[model samples]
Target: MGLPGEMRVVEISGPGGPEVLVPAVRKVPQPAAGEILIRVRAAGVNRPDLLQRAGSYAPPPGASDLPGLEAAGEVAAVGAGVSRWKVGDEVCALLPGGGYAEYVVTPADHALPVPEPLGMIEAAGLCETFFTVWSNVFERGRLTAGESLLIHGGSSGIGTTAIQIARARGVRVFVTAGTEAKCHACLELGAEMAINHREADFVAAVKDATGGRGVDVILDMVGGDYLPRDVRALAPDGRLVMIAHQKGAEVSMNFSLVMVKRLTITGSTLRPQSVEAKARIAEGLFREVWPLLDTGRIAPVIAESYPLEQAAEAHARLESGQVAGKIILEVA
Candidate 1:
């Protein structure tokens, strides 16, 4: 595809609060080799998006500085050496950065065909949460059938996705939420146990639910003080995958627990991953996970959708930490 002269995009002029996000018309990006140009219809606002805006998370070198990470749109054009997708394909993609725009370019390998039942809003909501869960919890953590998985922040996008994925695979899921209502919502989504973190110790509740066996895997986004409790909640030979440290990153924890239990700890970020790595993930999802999506075994849970221009308001809602599922930005 040939280059475009200009585009409309949401730009973060500086590191600051949500007020810093501005919608502006800029030069439209051209699709390079192995890339495709998408006329984005919707974009997903994720926790990392906020972190990037706050200056704590920076896009890797050569990636776009724009804040959005996941998007669903129709392909406008395809670059040289790309054959799998062509112009007019309705696709959703996991982008490293630069998704908050009317038109954005992504590696063709990262563009996935949207499941027929999912609309643009739902498709846009898929990438970040699902990618994070599939990579960290399922792939790295090696969560298996009949095993127990505990996810912190059950009401948010990642938590909701993890709960559903684990449940679909026949694993018993336990989640922690800030309120009784959130806990109830997690149970409604098929979680075996939903603990109110504000009122109960998740360690005790999970231990009780598992009959002292502890959980086999944990998807923890809250770092800092939760680290010790997470280790305490894990079973022998368990895995704990840390995706973020919303409270704080650094913490002091005992080494004896890890050594004695033989727990595995690892994590990966989608944005900085190479094209080949993302392609592998896309392939794995298409073969193993997409069928589940089409069969209605797993679905995107969208809590709200805001017009692309009201992104600031969307950010405010996400910052409140009260959303029940994924928040979306409708670009069209």
Candidate 2:
């Protein structure tokens, strides 16, 4: 099949609000060696995308300035030296950038086959959150089966995925969300208890839930004052993985707790990592988490979707902080 010369994309006209994302046409990118061209069907809207749109996060060198980080689609073309996939194969992938377009090129190894029971739309929401949760909650945090985990932002895409995946692996999951409805949604998705952060003290709740021993690991996206509480909420040798600082990055926390408890503090951002590193993460997911998705033990929670042109409105919805899960853009 012949490829189209031009494709539609959502571009950041200027760094500002969601209204800056405007539709425009651009030449379809050709995949280079070790890369594959994907005819994008859907793209996920993430917090990083919002940061990029607002000029707080810049795309790394050689990455497209477009604002999407993950997408699902069919392979449209294969570049030289690529072997795992060919035209017409369905895939969901983590991208360095450029997922907002109708066609995107990414390292072939970064893409995973769409799970058996999921379509392009749902698969679109899978890569970013799953890869993030796996890398942080399991790999970095070292959360193992039979341990307890505390997840902040439980109603979020990352939180929802982490809750289910951790629960499926025999890890008890506790979560904190901003509202009662969001907390309930987290509980329904396998969280042992969902604390309404706005009303309840998460540190106290976690301590109470774990019999005052504290959780074994915590996946925190809300930084700021929560850092001290997160430190206090961990059991000895517990791991605290920070992925974002929505509340604020700076904090004043007592180091005595960290040292006395022997807690581990770590964090990572997905987009800036090297291709080889991300490919390794993809492999891990293929072996460990994909089966859960295939068997219906876990799944992506889609809050809403918008047409590719209405990317601005989608951003508005996400920024409203009312969404319970992933937001997506339907491209094809």
Give all TM-scores, in the order shown.
0.97, 0.99
TM-score top scorer: 2
- lDDT of each residue in 1-332, candidate 1, tens digit only: 55468777888889988898998888888889999989999999998999899898999998889989999999998999999997889999998788889888888988889997899999999988888888888788988898999999998999999988888889999999998889998999999899999889999999998889899998888988999999999999999899888889899989799999998887777777888988888887888788888778889889999988788888989999889999999998
The prediction achieving the highest lDDT against the true structure is 2
**lDDT (tens digit, per residue) of candidate 2 on 175-218:** 99999899999989989999988889988998988889999999
Report the error of model 1 at residue 20, Å. Answer: 0.4
Name model 1 segments beyond 4 Å from true: 1-4
lDDT of 2 at 148: 97
lDDT (C-alpha) at residue 258 in model 1: 93
Q: Which lDDT value does model 1 have at 271?
A: 76
lDDT of each: 0.89, 0.95
